[model samples]
Target chain A: MSLTTDDVNKIAYLARLGINAKDTASYTENLSDMLKLVEQMSSIDTDNVTPMAHPLDTIQRLRPDKIIEDNQRDHFQSIAPQTEEGLYLVPKVLD
Target chain B: MTMHTKTLKQLSQGLQTGEYSSQELTLAYLNRIQQYSALNSFISVTEAQAIAAAKQADALLTAGNAPLLTGIPMAHKDIFCTQGVKTSCGSKMLDNFIAPYNATVVDNLNAAGMVSLGKLNMDEFAMGSSNETSFYGTAYNPWADNTVPGGSSGGSAAAVAARLIPAATGTDTGGSIRQPAAFCGITGLKPTYGRVSRYGMIAYASSLDQGGPMTQTAEDAALMLQAMAGFDPKDSTSAQQDVPNYSTNLNNSLQDLKIGLPKEFFDEGLNNDMATAIETAVNEYKQMGAEIIEVSMPHLKLAIPAYYVIAPAECSANLQRMDGVRFGHRCDNPEDLNDLYIRSRGEGFGTEVKRRILVGTYALSAGYYDAHYIKAQKIRRLITEDFTKALESVDVIMGPVTPTPAFGIGEKTADPIEMYLADIYTIAINLAGLPAMSIPAGFIDNKPVGLQIIGNYFAEAKLLNVAHQYQQVTNWHQQTPKGFE
Candidate 1:
């Protein structure tokens, strides 16, 4: 499963990386080589195998879903690139 | 005394006796930093803050209130968050990012009264094996200026090896700590997955990323580990177990202990020099009354494939928090919402980072998830089971840390596959989520070979004892890189 140029463009778009057509050839080549290497898993017999998510196979202990801590919205927003009215401001999407 | 040559014990002893103030020790290291600027080991040095903390520690000591590690100077890999300090993680994404809080390990170390030397350089987001991927610059091996220092913890290993600091903290995802320590001729350990809290330590692969110590000897690693390990409520994955006295078992004899030699680890592609050094070290253990047995880990071949998928897949999600909006570098021109994402990420991330994000995106993309991402997770279980079987027969597993000694700068940079192959021996340990260490076993062609000692989960104390006993009988750990002295 080699990545086509269209696939590279779509992946870059999803990843939010600005990969243009000029560099798509190189990206395609590199991604394909890496995928080829990763593709070795296809030959393995994993029919009865269960996927292990955590290193230690244990269910995560969850804390009660409660807002115990105070929200320092103003303090946190002080470091944002562009924030106004306690909201992160980006370019207008609908406009 | 130079503080660089002094072990943690010696530094602690000096602090207790009032031989020199913590300020003086920090100054000694700072002076060394100025002298060894060519090595490019440190990313940021908080001279004023370090001195102020040292002075405060001295006051506490004079008032008969000193902790176990009062005033000892050490540095952290830039990956660990330090309150109000710029924790760059050696990437441009967080170049201007000042962490609002200290990582759990940093808070614990500060509580123990250790002084922060600075933030050490590392590969960008702790991704690459060599420090070459760092946005700041590549870290030079103080041992041989021409060769590369192994990464992504190259800066910490180089700093310790060059005697710039007594010890430093490092993170090992896939041999980031051990390989660098091997190349720089020092001691480095990666504790079991949950042994150390990852809270505030920037996540690479949450499951595999473990914070440990890189020091001059196994004893120093034990002392440092005492402060680093603990369960933290903030990090959900942190184990809620008591951290044992790692130093207490330092004097335990390795006699009658069983060491496992994995047949696959010693097979083809294993460099003759590294193989010889490992075998010689095993023979030394035998002479010391230890039994060696052959072990097998059949899933070894799938480790790199499994790791590439799982690590990148996790990394993609982990790094999403680094977008331009929060804090750090942001692009000037933005066309729209999509442009903001593209421009910010493109300008912020380094080449290796972008490469990983691309690979990760494809793996987790629609129609390919089962073939790549999920299958890798399935194989991860097989690798862990292999270790469990191996450990049932032996006290610890021993092998070479890397196939070859440190290579020259730009030697394999152009060929990414070649560079990835360098991490083959170390990645398996991360896959199994086991505790492992790289101790200076012997030298090959004037370069050092690290004898990797791996233990089952939560077996750091046993691994340290094995390395410590080896150090007692052998002087290999004492060898310093040339010109460092």
Candidate 2:
């Protein structure tokens, strides 16, 4: 299986990680090598197989919807890369 | 005696009788940690925090109300979140990351009066078989300075093995805890899925990641598990069933016990020394009156394959939250929104982590879901069924933790496939949602080999009982690294 530079960029795009043209060669080889390993899955016959999303088949249990934590904003935002007014600041995405 | 030689119960008793204050015990562990600093076992030591907590625990002991682990010192695998402490997860991406809240495991340990010693190093995002992938550097095997301590919980295992700390918490996604414990010659357990809460443990294949204890003995692992286990509303998948006293059956006799030896586990690739040591241990069990049975988990070959698909797919999704926007690392220059996402993640994650993300993204993509992801999930069911059937005829399944003992630091780090193969015998337990433990069985060429015990769903007590009984008759777990002390 061969992944082109375009494919690597597309996968990165979908994954929400940016990758440029120059890094594509290394990404291509790595991704292709990984796919070859993953290809081993194709050999196993999985007909009528039920996908297990969770190890246990139990449904989500509801909680009391109570606020058990308090006064953690200052403690939490203190670690953010960029923050102000109890919120994290990020690069502008708007026009 | 080394502070690490004492079990949780023994330490609790000492605290109760005023034999030693928590502060003194904390200082002893701190001194040992300093003595073994060359091992690179601890990433960050919270000395002030640990002493303060120990003082509080001493006050509780003075009041005759000491908890199960009151004043006992413990270490956390780097993956677990500790409020106001650096949580690198052995990755450069989170090098500067400081968790805002304590992980559920950390919270529970503190509640039980256990003092935090420090954060232990791990594989980058808990992704490797050896600790070499750690961005900080590889943790030295305290047993042999030239070799690696198994990973991604290598540091925790080393700390316990070197007698630096009594025990430490570890998270096993795909054999992280067990492999390291086996390599470092300590006991480590990964409870049945949902038995321990994962609220603050940094996500690594959320479906497979589980937090458990790595300690010098099975009984100590039980006490640590008792405080760490049980349901938490914060973790949706936590089992609602009552947690039994894990120590309740610790000293039980293994007579009439049925131990299953998986034939597939003894396949061609297994190292002869490991095989011999394991067989000797099994013979000891037989001599002790436990019956041995040959059990087959036919789909064993598919475990490694299925895990690669499912774990990476889940990891791809779990790690997306680490982008620069919310917290952690960010790029210096951001041309646009996309550039911020690209530069931050591209520069933050290591090569192996990025590779897994790409693979996972490819597996979960629309065209590949049924062919790759769904197929792996289907094979996963068969893997679980194999265990269910094997357990029906046997009380517990026993096998080699890894095909061989710990390899050189960089031996398997470059080859992803070889690294994946290291977890062949252990990943099935995670897929099946069963509790399993790794205990020191014997040595192979002076390196420790672990005997794996797999129990039915939520059978941690029985598993510990089997391990404790074996430990009573054997002294493998007591052998410490000679020069480290």
DockQ of each: 0.76, 0.69
| DockQ-based CAPRI category assigned to the predicted complex of candidate 2 | medium
DockQ for model 2 equals: 0.69
Top TM-score model: 1
Cα displacement (Å) at residue B347, model 1? 0.7
Best by DockQ: 1
**How much lDDT does candidate 2 score?**
0.88
- iRMS, all models: 1.2, 1.6
lDDT of 2 at B182: 97
TM-score of chain A of each: 0.84, 0.80
Report the C-alpha lDDT of model 2 over B86-141, residue by residue, as the tens digit.
99999888999888888899999989889998899888999887888888888888
C-alpha lDDT of residue B328 in model 2: 81
Clashing pairs in 2: A18-B342
Error of 2 at B264 (Å): 0.7
List runs of model 2 lying over 4 Å from the truth.
A18-26, A64-74
